[model samples]
Target chain A: MRGDVIALDVGGTRLKGAVLDERGHALTTLERPTRATRTPAAVVESILGALADLRRRPQAEQAVACGLVVPGIVDSVGGRAVWSENLGWRDVPLRELAARRIGLPVVLGHDVRAGALAESRHGAAAGYRNTMFVPIGTGIAAGMVVDGRLLDGDGLAGELGHVSVGHEELCACGAKGCLEAVASAAAILRRYRSRSGAELGGTQEVVSLAAAGDTVAGAVWTEAIDALAAALAMASSLVAPEVVVIGGGLSLAGATLLEPLQSRLDSRLTFQRSPRLLTAALGDRAGCLGAGLLARSAMAETVGVR
Target chain B: MRGDVIALDVGGTRLKGAVLDERGHALTTLERPTRATRTPAAVVESILGALADLRRRPQAEQAVACGLVVPGIVDSVGGRAVWSENLGWRDVPLRELAARRIGLPVVLGHDVRAGALAESRHGAAAGYRNTMFVPIGTGIAAGMVVDGRLLDGDGLAGELGHVSVGHEELCACGAKGCLEAVASAAAILRRYRSRSGAELGGTQEVVSLAAAGDTVAGAVWTEAIDALAAALAMASSLVAPEVVVIGGGLSLAGATLLEPLQSRLDSRLTFQRSPRLLTAALGDRAGCLGAGLLARSAMAETVGVR
Candidate 1:
């Protein structure tokens, strides 16, 4: 526990790693293509190779533990990846495998949940006892923090994207009208494409067209904002978090997203306190920083108890 | 602490009281009619008189605390009744007033949340670390228990009634298509009335008619159950609670409600664990028992600590 810890963040299309100090300040970082289509075992090997490369660095001998985070359901208590549709992994003994391979104690967590932990401790949600961290990227998900603790809910919680808001649009999940089907960045692009019959490059292009006063683009953007507001307002009424930290790709829209969304949420709520909406501060590094912090804390706990 | 504590449960139309020991066993219980249309001061006086009469018994002298549970939003952290639409109360310091008059410590809690606490402690949700107690009565609301702790959420959480579930039906809360607008017992009766143009006596009568194979009644029952299941399934995906305890007036429908609701919920969820659905073991007395337990715990915390 004298020096830094190694952290790895696994996403659907990319693998990111970092070596950080005790305070979670990154000393070095690396990124590699996920290539998940190969196999789960190959992905594991890639992660190990990344860890080994980090260990070969000049200060590698200072590392004491390893932390890893991945998308989808994770059984953190049992140290298993319960399921990851994106990673094609189920019941993988991730923590034990990482420990055996790296020869160091390992901390495992859900990617979004770990990002939320990072935000609560060192970024936008710091000082708030209750916060909802929602990341709207290729998909929509939330990590809820209550009473200064992240809610794992036995690893099945934080599936806010699937909460039905009744749009009647077909979702990839085989459900009609889910929030992720209409409000995520990918959904915004899809809606724009369907309405204007012009294949917009991405959500950013739609935002640019809306900024230039294109009616169809504006309508799609407005609907996405409305859908997000509806979901956030309902969540606020139920959880009353002090703040909501919006992250992921769509968040780059900034005030374009927050203004109408806040107004709609305010119109819907009657009795609950309106939570302040803010952008995530950690950006793409949140999950890695969070994993490093978790590893550091785990090492501390082990030593203190001993 | 050596004798029974006084517990009072204030509902929309009735007031129930009980004398209970530290273990929540009732020593004596009483009930009185409540007319909410009466003056608030008169209601308070009536409750005081009932408690005074109960305290006149020989076993009352050793009592050291009192507990009161009431409907609507309560700021337990501030020891104030924030609002009770049913009781016409706003910002009332009921806990302080009750404690001063009774010459003993008093605890206040939301009625449904208290019932949930009781269920988690002694009833269907017992032994579960995470539970959601949803009471679908005249209205729908929930009490959430996470990691064995009741989430008060600054007195604004647990408004499960207002969560939207795709229904376009207008709600009394002014929101179109809230869960309560479609799934509550009153909502079921309203749906039946609107469909058949016939006045049903109550939810029980509607259930009996449906059981007798009345088509209109069956349709109404089925719609309400579907709406409830939809909302509960969404909640299950987000919270992943170990158990969902159903209580209140509509729960009296028993298997007629449980069977269809469970099947519909199972069909909707894909990744989350299916929680055990069970009837609340504690009857109407749950609120008072939970209030007593709260009072006892608060007193012990305050007096036992050096």
Candidate 2:
């Protein structure tokens, strides 16, 4: 048997774990709160504990390797979590520690990049050699597959959110006019709340309010869409992907977002090829699935013709 | 014995041809006016004639293959010149035709991309796996080396010149505010001439005037540099190349261009990795050297592996 692989995706608020077989089918799944307010060492302990818990499951008995993906700047090759503002960590060697504890080879990856790999292999971006998977959540980040290879420029390549879209809003990164500052899910909700002086539960509520003819909601949503369009237009002109797979929390808006974004991008582009925009097929599971894929590749490299 | 190869770089007004050995050393070189105003067929004929002339030389007697690179949109896989506004051609199967006449396997490539390959192999960006080769001539285009592979997004990946950099000038491609519209050598000269009402001989004269404290010339030069900085900042965010090699006519300005560009890019970036700005080491011969490399790779594939 090729055996299964253990996959873990660690985000700011959640840790999603899965035991996936050769074909990337999840044999077993687990999820838990990250509780990242704890020390970086505590977070590391929690991750190891989750892996141990998953390993105890019957489906993970034959797991050949483990793949762990984390948000923020990751040194994938070095198997280090370089930096994570949400988790308050820097240069933690997660893979080496996990490999020693788990008694299996471990592969480390960036969350967004792993998600992109998963999408390219088994999700909406499958079959497209050049694809950009942009996930708009608390922040926006891009996972680019260029010429059928994931672009990892020392873990700094796919920072679409930080790129200025000619706006004036200040980003958390201390840059002005970042796409994330103006168009992320948190930004949209915050912008709406501040503009209308009304309390909103989430970005979805703002989208709903816009649909129901609320002026502030409509303006906020439109600006977000316009910002997204501007960023995508710049992406198209630079990378020229055949398609862009939109994912994360805000992607749930579906056609409400895709239609206007496509039109806006079309109007902005003159000589550049306009990429077809589609909502992500795998939803939030992409990162976990990508971890599974990473583990599988490492397994293949170890057991096959090296 | 591994044989030599014929390399041809087709520009708007020049056809640069060379016979190079396996080590990429040019044994013989030739250059002639492209006369691109003629029909596409005539252009094709001129290319074929150039190859024939190169092949007849004593140094090219044992040439195994030919690599032909041209400007405009190129389908490297399909071996077709998809489009070239300067050459006035579209969808011309130049590779297959040249192969049939030249009696050698012909590899087609985009001139700038081929130049990037040359730079990656033997020029300024030789050791860096991720590099961007931006040649600022009559127009601006980028040849990106991402993770040691030249990016080819179906001939649409590296149109950095067309990416909007918040300028209002009209571009030849009918796009307003394109980087090329305000920052290209031609654009800089035209803007200077229009503003100063002085008939300057070339871009160098404008640079000289700018150095001599001519306000109009200085403004045009500064604007061009600023626009370049904006475009490069966008590229740095998207690709995060380790180094950016600036080539083409304007690169002759050397430190005058590199110093200001580096500082401006530094100011614009927040969290992105800043790439080292370097001038092209191969000068104008990069494209021909890249063609030779392309031909060498093709030869290796034919004889060594599938």
Candidate 3:
């Protein structure tokens, strides 16, 4: 309980690493680009390098275990990265590799789920037992906590992005009408560019244009909110979470995204409990913080106290 | 653990009572009409009368506890029937009333959730840890088992009935486009009558006519199946249950409902896992059986062995 731990959240483009004490307070944090590492082996090497760098920090001198989380289909129990389209990895035994190299016990988990755990325990969703953490970024996914337990239907429980919102837009997943096809950050930018024949660097640009009274941007943004509300209404109908923590890139839109989305979801619901919608408080550091908690748990389990 | 228990399922129209031995097999079953019991007090008397009748049976000689399940909002842990639109009750302490009269401890639960528990434990959803028991009756509701625990989102989880399925139909709950508005057995009958200008005694009559190649009946049935598939596809995306057990009066349609629903749900999915659709095997007795299980658990708790 007195030792520090090393934590890493390996995303598609960057590795967010942290050294944290047993209480989940970060002692030192670091971020490194993984965009240049194109292959699975290169990504693994980058992860090892990041871990080695963190270990060299004075704060991590007594690090007892490491927690590694990655995007895509992760087999948390098996300590394997099953598949990740963005990170370009499949069936990599990440825990074993890191543990053997770093000489510490390791725990593996899904990045989004880890973020959800962090948010539920210490951020916006804290105090709510049934919570949903939905991150709308390059892609959309949800991490749900029901009855104070994270739902892991074999790592397939929270595919909120893929549920259809009654749209005809084709999704990259070879399906039509997926929420991701219409409401994700990338989807919003793509829709805006195609409809207005104007280029925008990111979804925030479209949000700004919409706020500034651009009709085309307004229409695209409205469509995205509508799709998101439909998906959330469906989620509320099914699980009835007490709080929905909107995270990832689009959540940076703050009230611009949440206000209209909340009203729309409220209008759609009748008998189902309306979940309080809030922006994630931990911002982008949630995954790394959660990874630290996972490492702490691993250490506790080893000491037969968890 | 060695004693029998009395179980009662209180519905809007009837009270189904059962005396069960330790193994959950019904030693004796009885049914009584509650159609004349219009007020909450009258309904309570009807329930007590039914319980008295069941207690007179030889199978109830060693009954130790009673499980009472009612329709509508239930506070299971508080042993209260919070509200029932159907039974015209509000904040009734049914468990205390029943326990005092019967001279035994009592457990209370929601009827649909009880049916789900029974189906998951001993019926269609047996052997599957992640299962959804959706009974499409006069009304539609779901009982979900996630990670081997029944989700009690403050008794507000699993309102699959009210989720919109892209229809314009107005539901009894004052909501438009609800799944219950389009897909419940009652909705199917209403749709058939409004479309065909024919009066049907039951939803099964519409099913029979559809099977006999009536175009209007076929259209109504197809619409119901489409709406169900849409709602279920959404459920799969959210919870990713391993199996979805279709119960209630609609399941009597058997392969007619299951075949097209499975195909339609399959067509809606892209990357999410498809849950196997199965019919409820316990028929109308599921609620009664589940109540017995609840009673058994209460007795086990009293013995400090659960």
Number of the predicted model whose TM-score against the real structure is largest: 2
Best of the two (1, 3) by DockQ: 3
Minimum summed lDDT over a 10-residue window in model 3 chain B is located at: B31-40
Candidate 3 Cα errors over 4 Å, as ranges: A298-306, B55-58, B298-306
Winner on DockQ (2 vs 3): 2
- Put down candidate 1 lDDT per residue, A217-305, tens digits, no spaces: 99888888888887887788677899999999888888888877888988877766778899999998988888887787778888883
Candidate 1 residue A94 C-alpha distance from true site, Å:
0.4
CA lDDT, candidate 3, residue A4: 89
lDDT of 3 by residue, A1-306 (tens): 668889999988889998988778889998989756478899999998898899888988889889998888877778888888788888999889988888888999888889999999999999998999999899999999988888887777888998888878899888888999989998898888888888899888998898899999999999999999999998998888999999999999999999999999999887678889999999999999989877787678778885
Give lDDT tens digits, candidate 2, residues A183-280.
99999988887887888888889888889999999999999998898888888988899999999999999999999999999998986889999889
List model 2 lDDT by residue over B120-184, tens digit each: 88999999999999999999999999888899898888999998887778899987879998899
Q: What's model 3's lDDT at B238?
A: 83
User: Predicted candidate 2: what Cα RMSD to the true structure?
Assistant: 1.5
Off by over 4 Å in 1: A1-4, A55-63, A195-197, A297-306, B1-4, B35-37, B48-56, B300-306
Chain A TM-score, structure 2: 0.97
Q: What's each prediction's TM-score?
A: 0.93, 0.98, 0.95
Docking quality category of candidate 1 according to DockQ thresholds = medium
Best candidate (score: DockQ): 2
The full ranking of all candidates by TM-score, starting with the best, is 2, 3, 1
